[model samples]
Target: MSAKPWPEGTGCRILQEVDSTNAEAQRLAPTLSGPEWILAHRQTTGRGRRGRPWANPVGNFTATLVMQPGETPDKVALRSFVASLALFDAFVAATGRVALFALKWPNDVLLNGGKVAGILLESAGAGGTLSHFCIGIGVNLVAAPSRSDVDESAITPVDLQSETGARVTPEEFLDLLAPAFADWEAQFSTYGFAPIRQAWLNRAAKIGEVITARTGKESVVGTFETIDDTGALVLKTASGRRVISAAEVFF
Candidate 1:
């Protein structure tokens, strides 16, 4: 178990089951005074980005961190990077293997080049501010979905136990992740996204390597470049530099 203590002013609640942690965050946002971590051992209706169904096998880790971030939507969205760094730290702490992990662009963590975790961000508000923001995280702790479960071009899913022989529970993983997140969040709140962007870049996957970014409209193939200050994926394409705000990256 991680010796890391929980963050101050943060609330944590564990549920035996839920529809989805993100959904629960939405329901609890109105009543929450500070940040809260909602963890669910089982999710009946878990979903991912673009409303894709999330496969949550037994013994995996699933949770969401909800907060009433008073920043602009763009700023709030960048918290995905913060969450990524936290996951990286927690995974290393759990497995004692720092070199095996990498952070994928936007929001995914790779273990030995295979996907081991994913992050989904959801928020609601108007007038250029957010009422609440939730960062939903799902980690393959003990078991992963079959190869046929994901997209044809997607990276294969991997489990921590299968890969590293680490048997961390959902609650234990949360214990490590919550404090790590709070630390990165503190940096973000104090110094802004510059340091976070640099730190994330240092741990990013496929840097300077050829990759493909597919959006709803088209696919752009280019060398993986640095993420811009606004958290857009910057790629050096054949024609010119392309700054993609959103896309499905394949490497």
Candidate 2:
């Protein structure tokens, strides 16, 4: 991997195969002196939100960024939005198309209204302060799983190659992504989540439409309002505005 595009104090390792980049990042976090990245060409045991199996076939982008954010859990959680914006920018730069891509609430990248990428965040800390965080990202580059391979209610998967008719290798995607992420991270560090939130709102998937937010126990159906100050999804129900920190959103 080329080191020129990466941020200062960032270290990276590329592996041909791994059980999961996040797991590897966890093992390295305690010993890391600075920000580090772990990239896997193939992940045998990758996972998504709620421990769902993540398919990391060869040629897809599978990587984990491990860093010590040194912030409160609420602030650290905002990285998901930051990462999503970076991913959106990177995909647009790689494909040179801005119309087909949108960012789902919280942290999923949609291509032509289909799920093309997902973000998973894991952290270890105590007393509301984060010691380290692992931001695991997976993007479908060459191929996407069939509808039968995923949950029936989940959005159909889409791949970059199929949508753009241009071959995009994982390496090339990461090269574009690394610099984009650094740019957003710098913005987040300087201006806080307000700027990031506004940027996210601009590319949000269904801002004014009614959507369903399933939070495991119950479901809330309401108009998709803006995200709140703390990065919660604000939904306008008949009763009032409801904020959700985590849930499965369906449009």
TM-score of every prediction relative to native: 0.99, 0.96
lDDT of each: 0.95, 0.90
lDDT string for model 1 (137-202, tens) is 999999998999899889999999999999999989999999999999999999999999999999
lDDT, residue 106, model 2? 76
lDDT of 2 by residue, 1-251 (tens): 22236677788899999999999999989999988878899999999998999987789999999999878887888999999999998888887789999999879999999999999999998888888999999999988999999988888999988988868787777777888889999999999999999999999999999999999988999999899999889999988989998899998
Model 1: clashing residue pairs? none
User: CA shift at 224, candidate 2, in angstroms?
Assistant: 0.5
For residue 122, give model 1's deviation from the true position in Å.
Answer: 0.3
